[model samples]
Target: MQGAQRNSLRLLQWMMAASLALPIALFVFTSTISYTSTKDIADREIERTLDVAHEHALKVFETIDRSLAELNEVVRGLPDEIIRSREPALHRRLKRLTDALPQLKSAWIFDANGKSLVNSLASPPQDLSFADRDYFYAHVDQNIGTFVGAALTPRPPYQGARFFGMSRRRETDDGSFIGVIQASVLPEYFESFYARIGSDPGSFFAMGRTDGVVLTHFPRLDRDFRLDPTGPVGQQIAAHPEHGLITIAWPSDGIERRVGYRRVAEYPIYVSAGLETSAIRARWLATMGQHLVFGIPATALLFLLLALAFRRTQHLHAEATARREAEEALKHSQRLEALGQLTGGVAHDFNNLLTVIRASVDLLNRPQLSEERRQRYINAIADAVARAAKLTSQLLAFARRQTLKPEVFDVGERMQSLHDMLATLLGPAIEIGIRLPAQPCLVKADAGQFETALINMATNARDAMQGKGRITFAVQAAATIPDTLVHVSGSHDLAGGDGLVSVAVSDTGIGIPAARLGRIFEPFFTTKQVGQGTGLGLSQVFGFARQSGGEVTVESEVGQGSTFSLYLPRVPTDLLPQRQAPNTAPAVAGSGMSVLLVEDNIELANFAADGLTELGYSITLVDNATDALAELTMDAERFDVVFSDVVMPGMTGLDLAQAIRDRGIRVPIVLTTGYSQALSQDGAAGFDLVQKPYSIEELSRVLHRAARLRPVRDGAAE
Candidate 1:
């Protein structure tokens, strides 16, 4: 429970973090959008203010410029006498001109000597030399076109007042130097016009020239006409082009603003407008706070809900995993119980066979034994040994490790051979049925495993029927089908279609349950009482069928009994030609052919040696293949045949046989083994082979055949 809670908490933490993070990210995005939109709106408002300021400032300059032009034209016709005399008409014209132009403070003319000829506002002092003025030198030297001068203080009547001048040069008819016609406007005129636009509450406007000269500026500076380019506002304007918006602190006032400036066309004046920088930033901050107010709480609520859902899901998954593990543990315990039952059954069967052999040996040990009694004792021991071999073979088959010797044989023939054995195994009470197809069901597999599997199925059928029902062992060729486990629902011809060979053992007795049918082939799974069955009979059948490249299937209903079918893959008819069973008749004689008998067991060696001598063969005995090889090496031509027993300790009999041939010795060689593995391809190669526990007659025949056979040539049978 502690582990579960910890995992739940970890999952909830991650989920909550994800949910909250999403909304916070959205909040950031909303703030960014608001900041962008606010900046754009502020820029548009500033641009509009600049437009209005530019129009009014341009209008004021145009009005002043027009009046100057009109004055220049009117004074052009004045003859030489008007300048010589202090004329009343000129005086009246200058005073009336000053009264008509609202912005103009003075209108005057100056002669070639730089003396004031007449004044618009009042009379000027005769001793005042205007030559020192830059405007005077400007008109005297270049005597053409109108010139607008820098702001300056007027002398005498207009004293202590600053104004910017506009002047036109007066020339003779020959284009020679004459006099100047000039007008001036008070700086108050531009300042009053700038104050009216109201672009921003704390905005400033200025008029300047590119040459660092200031005509006039609103909110006036204390400096002279030469504007300071080194100042912040001045530096910003100088670095930019005619008209653009820039953020700069006004050096004259130290107020930061977004300023817009434009140069007037064909005039010495540049007009600039600006708005306070603090106002724009303040408006943007207000918008961002509105988004944050609603967003944070809603995000937290969503994160809590997601964390709860994740914690619930984790609890369900933990319960499901624990349930599955418990089921597997129960299965393991059941299998262990079955294993104990199987071992006890095997021990009981072997003990019975050992008891019979022991009883037979005791009877054979009496000194005065009759011939018929001696034969009976010998027969009992032989029968017990055969039963032991069968028991061990079945156990190996159940384990699926038995060596399989495959051969092409008719299934019908094999079933016919098991007729008497199956009848005796099932007892007299249970009747048997044998079925075979008209055509042969030829297959390649281990014949011994196949026969054992058949007997095992018969025994199982007898048990299912309580030893009183009919048992049928049938052989038939199956129809072509993709799946190995085929359901036979219709009739199939045995001769026409070539497919698998199926051998089925069926019973007309109590049927198996559908649940039990699937598990009948599993080792130690039986319905019988524990001591009555080892449960390996059906398992042996299953292992044999599969290991031989075949399949086993069961079909049953509640009361219709069961049919267990073993399906083996069919072989090509000509792959292995059928061989007739060799005659097991006793050998009549040996033609005195020399034989070297290599047998490891002392009792078996003496028996074989005595038997071979009686059969008239020259016999020699050795305990092992190593000693046999040494004996042959001392006199290579002494033995005509090397009969070695397979499966010795140091060197196997097959190894000795191969070594003799490797040295090019031409004597015939044969091998024998008690185990099935010795009959495999490697053991049976380049020599004749015979199974163990052979009779004296059987050994004699094999030895005679080995000596008669031609020597092996080039590692192959001749």
Candidate 2:
């Protein structure tokens, strides 16, 4: 059962871990795939935007080149002097061309001496020197097909705005350069077109010369800017001169971007469009945030449910364990109850038979029967009765119904006496060792039962050793009983004080197996083979310890040995009673005294009445307490003492005694029983109690003592 519960808990823990980990793993995986796909989409969009910008740049430059071609054709065969003479007509034609195209700022023709002979800005061209201009110098050497220059502010009329020029070199039939025809293109033309095309935030658009000169940019630069010759975009363009895409930081502001570039066809220029890398990241983050908004709660709820299930399983496991323990306790209680009933009944019946035999034996022990054979028969019968009494005592002890006479005694002194007795009983092959405390260890328990328990433990140990090992008895002051034993005993209420005295019996024997340790205290449970053991030794010890308000603990290892320790509630040394030496004098006979004898069994009643008659007691026999009560009520002064058996049919001896006291009867009552539950629970109840199967001599002394305890009556006054 415990194994299954643990497995269930382990499975839940694994599921909890998986529930959280799998979702996060999937979310991260899906987010990664989405990011890559989104970036690919962004790259394609950049390429498309760059394609539109590239087309625009190509058309504008081609138009500017065509105007230059037309201007060159007008002066194809004209001499330098004729071109100067036809300047007014050429200026009118250039003005018409500039008006037709919104992208073109103006058109110009430069003479070989670097004089601007014709211009579109003014009817008579300004005195701008073509000798210092880049276009004029380039045409002087060789005819480079359509040369696109760096952005610059044009002279006068086109000033305050930046422009780049497209120029063509004019040559004679000999292919020698003579002059230049140039057209100025406005940077605002591409910037306005880029705005119209509609780009995202943080997007860039630019056109630049292949020589790394930036011509025009949307969201224009504060000052003229150029791409570095050795930078990322510059290297990208050099590697793929026609068209390609690259992600790089803009040299102007260091903002990372995904850029697409294309080289305009047959022109020394490139166009690019880009969107910032931060914008792509923003798109990805927004998508992932949406996933988290839904995913996090689902994971949390799964964890919460798993946590609840784990707690619920633990609760159920606890309840199951509690229920199992309860059932076990109930079964044990029932077993003890049944044993008590059986033992009490058997002991009660057996004691009556022993009483009859004892009475017969006492009759034979008279001095007149001086024959050796008759004396031997009486001695043998007496021995048998004593042995039978011991047997019944063991049964009553195991049933936990034995009468206990508790007295505060020193444990160390008691063990010292047992050390010698056990040594002889266990034989020469066994050794007995004794360990005593320096100070007296005092306990309140039945001294006879205590010795019996120790003897039982020692005998078991002797058998375990096969009568060939060492047995040790020790006494000590303990703070409390061991927690393990406390739980095993389940007698927490017995451990009352901080002071506990431990009397431990240890043996170096073969030891008990672990599998059998827990059942060793159960009645009829023994490791010995049949007929060799009664199996009630340890159970008797267990019941005796519990009935004495203490607990017994056993510790054993298979090959090492076993220790049986009794933990009894300690008493103060001051509570110990003064020891009295045993009196060796013969039993005193009774004078003519009256005894009201209450017995349910007629044979046993006759036997007791005859025995007491021989002891010089005047007996009034009654079979039940009711008859005795009626006799006492009729003549309260007849008997001096009531010697009633404790167990009878209608009313018990204890109840009769109470009735006598309640009726104000002045007689002393003496109760006797073999085994009575009432006697066990309520004790002697201020009445003197003698166990059954008593010797006639002992019965004489008890009747005499009870008669002595009676109150003297004022018969003269009555």
Candidate 3:
């Protein structure tokens, strides 16, 4: 009886093992099948989205091209007298053509002297000059029949609107150029076309011009969404004009999305469509859920049957315990990871607030606070604010929250600026050396962030050396590595081509240990004393480099020093000239006649009104557009300029300007905002824009200069 029981127990154990193993094996197979099927579906969907977006983009190009061609034909048919004449009949005929063509916002015939001859809209008296216009020169010099001008917000004829001009040279029967017939298409037409192209819910579609500025987008387009072709997405599109798609998992939302892009051949524009991966996985999840629903009951039934048939089942409990422990470990690691990310985000936002407060406080004592005792107290407060701001900036750097405004700048120039400060920081015990090329070796990065990173690294080096060491800063063009060459360091080989810049910072100190090197970039993982380091220096540098579309790598050994190399992508030659120092405020101006002030911030508005009044300009203050329009209708000529905030309660500043223009009120409109680039193109166009948090000097200058100007016809309109 005992022998029989032992054999039966062994058999029961084997049967129980198979039961658990079979379901797990089947689960793996099902998951693989589901993943493969889902990926296939996603690929097909992405391709379809790209195809639809491209088709819509092409249609826009064709519609504009055809409309311009028709306008050119009409101009060709007209006699030279009729074309050059500003007769009401001629204007009526052109107006009819413009009205008949829905896409054509306005049609005009301009003689060689750039005067509006038979404009579809109101004809301004002055003879316009086209010699300066890009489209005009392209038609005149290059003799390109169909010249499409850049996206322009039409100023005059149809003020406070956005349009792009399409021009064609009008030739006489003798084949000699007589004049240029131009048609303007409203951007709304393009925007509408994109909207009709159809988009998935929770998905976004965007079209970017050749310059990397977003032309249109489904839903709303944020100010920062504009084409910055040098950005990561822009660079990808530029480099790969063919079918390209990228999948990114948003860390903030925990949502994955796939962005698929295709270039439209007719124009230098790329149409992109995105689909949320979570949405795509919904069906798969549902199916899996159903499977699990059935699986649970089936699994329970199998367990009950085994317990009834077998006298003992000790092995099952041991296996279950092991699985639970493994799961627990994974959960623990994930919790830690999440906590770190949350800490970083909090640090970043706090830093930005500190920066604003510090800057504001510092500005308070600028006009000589050194004399008065109270002024000295205020200065002390400002100093404390500055220190707090610096601490926040460091936290933000560690958290990767600070905004990076990058531009192409010479590494040598940047290094030179920091040399003295770095030397002072290191003390007499350490030596600092910089080796940079005489010629500008430009890298695209935010100067402030880069400087901060360098200083942090230098500080780390100082600490490692125990306040004595030699630090070297060097920059050069990265060596071109052939595609076929094998790299032993596991680093991605730098692509061979022009326009690559590299920055290297090396320190002669007790180097990092091999074991600790990998952990160096982990926040709060410091080797220093509790009070000495927050353990975020290397991490900040890593984040800054990565955010700038660059890579940072370290080379170190136990005894030798450490070398950190930053590889930043090069700016194109054409873009290099456009690069300038980032300015906090607009250049200041001195005097003006009359001004309209629209600000919701009561204190800021009062301050501005006082400042403008002091600057010899009469100021009309209104809280919102309703009051401004009521005032404007009462006396349009009373105001020389319209100064308004962008984000107001009821009618936006743009809407108010549009309303004023609709009522035939023409004045130089200046729009100001704390978040300057956040305004849409339609809202920002036609008026001069000034970013806010402005000094009195900046506000005065903008108003004075803008007030001095009268409404002039845009060259592109002609």
Candidate 4:
């Protein structure tokens, strides 16, 4: 099932990836095609505009050519003197023709000797010499049919606008060149027509001679200019003399454009129309933007749907995984339940023995008993009870049900204080060594439990060496547990918070077998001869380490030695100073010190009330926290201290204590329980706590401490 789910997840991921990639690929392909198409349209439009300019230029040139031919015919055989005499009639005819053609500025007739004979501008025109003019010299020599000249301003007194000359050679019947009949073509004529046609912005129309001499241009220049004969446009004109298209920058302005050129038929002039490349691209972008405006959202919506499908597939995969884990957990729990039942039965039998011993001890307290025998019985009973309590405490710790009172303390300081005690326990035969780090290593946990775990490991080490080997306790700050150590039982995730503090207890003794390490943490599992070891020591260490958010690890080599290391979450040393546990001595209940005792167990409550009453505490007994809270509510000052059990049905002691305080009652609260997960996890909520099966002296001390914390009133202690 897992393999199939994984395959399905992979398939969904691929589908989602393809869903996004395919649309982007298609959008890019379409955009590319659109760009090429738009450019083609732009190219064709430029060609068409060029053709229009060509036709307009052709008709104007043809009319000018025809007029020039007519003038040449009229003067075909006439001498200069005869033509000069008929100047008035000729001038009137030329004026009429010039007036009819808006493009014509003026017409002139020049003698071969470079003298102006008769001209259209004025009848009996000014006798300006044509010797220096280029048009007269061209006709005077070889016949260059319809010679077009470079752009020139008319001489002063005859100036209207810039124009270029178009001329035809005049000759007698012998076909020898006599003079020239020339027409002045106005540049503004084409520029005005170009404006009326409404061409795109930055586009231009131009007319030029074949030799790269610019004749006229729309959007005319401030000064006269010529095209480079070697440039792209000029080269195209030479290569494709009739017509062609080219994309090139205008030499005059360097603005790149798509230009189309046409050579005017039977004339030396060429006309071109151009559209700027920037403008063409603008058109293409506008089209592509429209496509994106619609296409992008559609693609995004498709992606969103695919994302939803992928999320659903992931959820299904998680459900399958959870089902598998649940089945495995159920099986594991069944195994744990079997083990728990065995342990519970043993604990039950042990408790019955303790009860019988306790009743016997109570009966022996009769008044008629002899002093010597009674003292001996009293000492024996005390020893047996202490041993039983310690055994039960070990069992609870191994089960992780002990109600721990955790506090922050310096590990190095605590370890230092244990040196003398450890020396006394191990005897002079076993050498003891203590190692500490230079810096203080602080940890938050039950300081008493931590010491007990250390002492348990040390005692085991002592027994392994038969009471004649060295034992070393090393404390230091650690980043993580060493991987080389065997993780017997407990969490392996020991590195957390600020880091970890490791307390390693090493022994020079016969090491434990590798096969036995795994089962060492099990309750009641032992390696020594019968009755020599309880096997609950390492188990208690394991439970304490796990409950403290840490772990215990061991490293050993058979016949050599073993090292047991305890790892606990480190507290920042700079955090508020370690709280010092106050020195507690056996306390006697004060006279008139009223305590509200809340307990659900009837027999236990009665025993506690009687015990405390004998110690001079005015005890008020209640079965549950509700009644205790009600008693406090009715008379807030009735009890100097509210002593309650932490674990109870309906309302827990912790809740009742909070309730009494929440109601503005100043009674001090002291809690007791065999084991409360609530107290272990979040502590006693600032209330004093006492462990179950506590002695009257211990109970009195806790109650006295709590009562002292009550608010003083009337300038006296409450």
lDDT of each: 0.75, 0.82, 0.69, 0.83
- Give the candidate number with the greatest TM-score: 1
For candidate 3, what is the TM-score?
0.40
Candidate 4 lDDT, 44-106, residue by residue in tens: 888878888889999999988999988888888889999899889988888888899999998
Runs in model 1 deviating more than 4 A are 1-68, 74-317, 361-366, 369-375, 410-442, 472-502, 529-532, 570-718
Pairs that collide in candidate 1 are none
**For candidate 4, which ten residues in a row score worst on lDDT?**
341-350
Candidate 2, RMSD to the unseen true structure: 17.2
Prediction-by-prediction clash tally: 0, 2, 4, 0
Better of 1 and 4 by TM-score: 1
Give the candidate order by descending lDDT.
4, 2, 1, 3
Ranking by TM-score: 1, 4, 2, 3
lDDT of 4: 0.83
Tens digits of per-residue lDDT, candidate 2, 1-718, equal: 7799889989998888999989989998999998998799888888888888888888887878777888888889788878778888988899999999999888888766766778888867776675666656766777678888778776654465777778888778998776788888889988999988746876788888888888888768878888887888878887888988888888877788888888899898888898889998888888899999999999999999999998898899899889989998998897897577456645655676577677767768667775875767677677768767776777778777977777888899988877678888889999888899999988887888888888899999999999898988888998877766523344557754648898888999987777777678866666788558767778788888888778888888888998889888888778777879975555556567878888888998899888878767788888988889899889878788888899888788899999999999888888888999987777898888888878677777777777887778757363
Across 505-609, the per-residue lDDT of candidate 3 in tens digits comes to: 888878888777666776666788855866667777876766665667777777798887766776544545554585566544444566888998899899988
| Whole-structure CA lDDT of model 3 | 0.69
* Pairs with backbone N, CA or C atoms under 3 Å apart (clashes), candidate 4: none
Question: Model 1 over residues 389-437: C-alpha lDDT tens digits?
Answer: 7767666666655556678898998898889988788899999899898
